[model samples]
Target: MTCKKNMVIIRSFKQRPVCSECQMRSLSGPVSDKKFKKLFDIDPKFYETSAFLRDIRYQYSLYQNLTEKQIAAFKRVVDEFKNPKKKQINAIVPKAPTKEEQAEHKQKRAKGLFQSERSTLRALRTK
Candidate 1:
């Protein structure tokens, strides 16, 4: 649905009742609210994955003029996905190395193919 400030072009399908989703529409982008329902009903966890993340990210960008309430609702859905209680598998990815480990890593990086990989200007002439 296209909108400009106060005016909006609301959609009407032949079968379903009138949409109460104008507010929802503004944030969720051009994908009809019906699609959201169908996807959620099929699997509530679908939104937690990359497909839904990509959809919402695109929607957020496409519909930049959403109200604060709609934005909150959008964030709530994302937060629900990120809730720790729902975590089952190895969601806790590996941790970053300590500073000493990082220093060691940098030292390793400075020693190996790093020198040979340098630009021609940075490389020394043959002895």
Candidate 2:
């Protein structure tokens, strides 16, 4: 296997191989602002919906103060969540599937045993 970041032959675990250096670096400490931004380019709704943030808010409520670095990190996450990069916008936009492809997907889905009653009815109708 190869490293996702550098495409070098991974010298890490076989289950989920990554570069040894990359793995070590990731495990060391808190991610940098630029790295954090690149990693978590999620929907703006995430700022409101994140469970981690909820936990942090609860902690803050009890403590009344967070460290400067923690506050800065929170602000950074909120800012990034609110305004996703242009590259992320393009990357996230998936191409529309054709009607034939959609039909094929429905057919494939219908063949599965574990599905809702609605799907069962649709499968029957399709037949």
- All candidates: TM-score: 0.24, 0.31
Tens digits of per-residue lDDT for model 1, 1-127: 4224454333555322322233334335444455344433323344434343444444555663445665566666666666745555555776779999999879978786565566554655532
lDDT of 2 by residue, 8-115 (tens): 443555434544445444433433456444434445345345544433443454464567776677767677667766676656898889999989888978886446
**lDDT score for residue 98 of model 1:** 100
C-alpha-based local distance difference test score of model 2: 0.56
Candidate 1 whole-model C-alpha lDDT, 0 to 1: 0.49
Superposition error at 116 for model 2 (Å): 57
Candidate 2, residue 91: lDDT: 68
Query: Largest TM-score belongs to which candidate?
Result: 2
Residue 26, model 2: Cα distance from true site in angstroms: 33
Q: Return the top candidate by lDDT.
A: 2
